[model samples]
Target: MNRHRLRLVTFDAFGTLFRMREHPALTYQRIAQAHGLKVVSEPDRLKASFQDAYRKQGASNPVFGRLSQGSRPWWKSVVRNTLIGSGCPKADVDGALDPVFAELFDLYAQAAPYEVYPEVVPVLETLRTTVCEDKVPNGMGKGTKFWMGVVSNSDDRTEAILQSLGLAKYFDFVLTAYHFGSEKPGRGIFDEARLLARNCKAEECLHLGDDLERDYNGPKLIGWNSVLIRRNNDHPVPAGVATASSLKAAFADD
Candidate 1:
């Protein structure tokens, strides 16, 4: 097993950092009822969809796969993907989705509708303060050179969402699926983020995320240290990699 001491810490956005719009399930339930779509009606089903929605978006965007993430607007891609995934016709997907997309926008008016995890704020506060107090490789002085960034499987809009919620300025840079033009599990997004973060050695940084494959294996393959934030489930720890029960635990060793 490789033991790593990190100088910078990057993150996987969406499930790993931001609060998911937990109400999406409820919103979808309403959509199903009004549209008579044979879609999920159960609470768990709706909750599941919130995550699934992004997966669908991540998988479908051609730009994301091309590694030009954050350069394009993912919201439009999202609307298109949502409609297609919902089984709407290609052309109708655009029209019928306008209002629904608007509803999501309304919900996500400023920052995403989902609340940041209880652990997130404190963890970020710690990182901010630590950067102010500690030294690391790369002349990273306490609070100044510690480059904090996010490699998200989301659109460029996510930056605005984070900024709206007061989390963006803390990030030196953010690379999303939109930025890379594809989502993770493919490594394209990760590579692009690393480039934006300046290709610091994998060991010099720790990546925190919620997924096993995308956030773990992808970066791990390239030598970056990984910390999986297991959410909504009890997962056996991965061999050679660390797991954080909460964001705070991730900073314990730091």
Candidate 2:
């Protein structure tokens, strides 16, 4: 892959740039206690409940609703169902659900739950302004320039959340599941992103993400260069796919 010809650098928001500092289930437990709702507080049990509820909620709601429709009812349902699944009585789940959801929502709205990777800022800065020394004739415009973008599977408040984390300024635009009506691993979102980066061809763009299927397969299927950033050393690197241990490593010239 020639960096000189690249015109766009797209990234997956979570894990690639930033990630939740703490599991949300732990926060749910504290919120429930504050609301005077007696519930299971075990980390394992709460995590299981949270996962189940989240999966169920996501499955049932094909499209993530927008903030105009109360900012994703599926999320609220996930919170409510999680409480019930965690041994909170149904009545308590109902009574305390609003406050619990509000607290969690606000918590997420700020940067309290997230931590940006050490190399994120510098990598983004480079990608945002990097320009090729030579011009290419593939309809990629003169002097080969690159723009920074985010194609993330997140809620409508993604821009606001990125702002709170102080990472929004680096992105030219954000394409989110809430706005696209489809999540990653789906062609529609990537298609939308391609249209957004009109100046770049599929091969001239690069997308970096943590999930192999969403970040690698999705973009590869659409002909975009994809890199998998494995922050954790545990997962096996997928065969024939570019893998990086950090954002810095991903963009480092070979």
Candidate 3:
């Protein structure tokens, strides 16, 4: 596929652009301990509990409670459940959930626990500023402008996180599932992104993300071009999927 023809290139935020600096369970454990709560679960158990809590929250309150409770309450529930599931006594968890959640919420909003991938900045710069000859099949034309944006299944913290990492300037917009009222693996979110591109069509857009279904199949199902970003080396690229190891590699042909 000739990427030069694409007008908008959107990315999935969390696993695509940046990720946590350390295991989230460890951070949670430390925070709980610091807040004078006794967490007796092992790290692995805590991690599992956190995952369970997150999934449960998402299932019960879709899109981070955009329709009902709201993002703050939804996240507070996740944190509270995580603490309870991780073997912290319910009484202690209840006492500290609010302050612990507040600190975690603020911590994630900054760059404290996250790290942007190495190749992200250079690749974004090349896409945003590099001009190419119109006659070249794979080159982006000087007159053809491409917009960059982020589509994340997260709360309001996404944009702040990007800003803290100095990545916000590269994108035209950031759409969070909570704010947008739709999440990935559903066409509404991807369609919202296309609409945000301003007069751009589905065929003129492309999305890159770490998840196979949400990032790859979801966009493709909506008539937009998509690439599955497989940053991990443990798994082989799925058959016939447009897979890339990194953002730079995704546009290597261009």
Q: Which ranges in model 1 have alpha carbons more than 4 Å from their true place?
A: 1-5, 21-23, 31-97, 131-144
Q: Which lDDT tens digits does candidate 3 get at residues 67-148?
A: 8899889888988988899888899899888899898878878998998899999999888874333532334346766778
- Model 3 residue 199 CA deviation in Å: 2.7
Q: Which runs in model 3 stand beyond 4 Å of their true positions? A: 131-142
Candidate 2, residue 85: CA error in Å? 0.9
Residue 5 in model 3: lDDT: 69
TM-score of each: 0.71, 0.92, 0.93
Which scores higher on TM-score, 1 or 3? Answer: 3
With a 3 Å backbone cut-off (N, CA, C), the pairs that clash in candidate 2 are: none
| Candidate 2 vs 3: which has more TM-score | 3
Measured with C-alpha atoms, the lDDT of residue 108 in candidate 1 is: 58
User: Candidate 1, residues 85-197: lDDT per residue as tens digits?
Assistant: 55445565455555665565555547646677778887787675553344554454554645678887665567788878888877888877665556677766666665666
Better of 1 and 2 by TM-score: 2
Clashing pairs in 3: none
Pick out the ten consecutive residues of candidate 3 with the lowest summed lDDT: 131-140
Write down the lDDT that model 3 would get.
Answer: 0.85
Output the number of the TM-score-best candidate.
Answer: 3
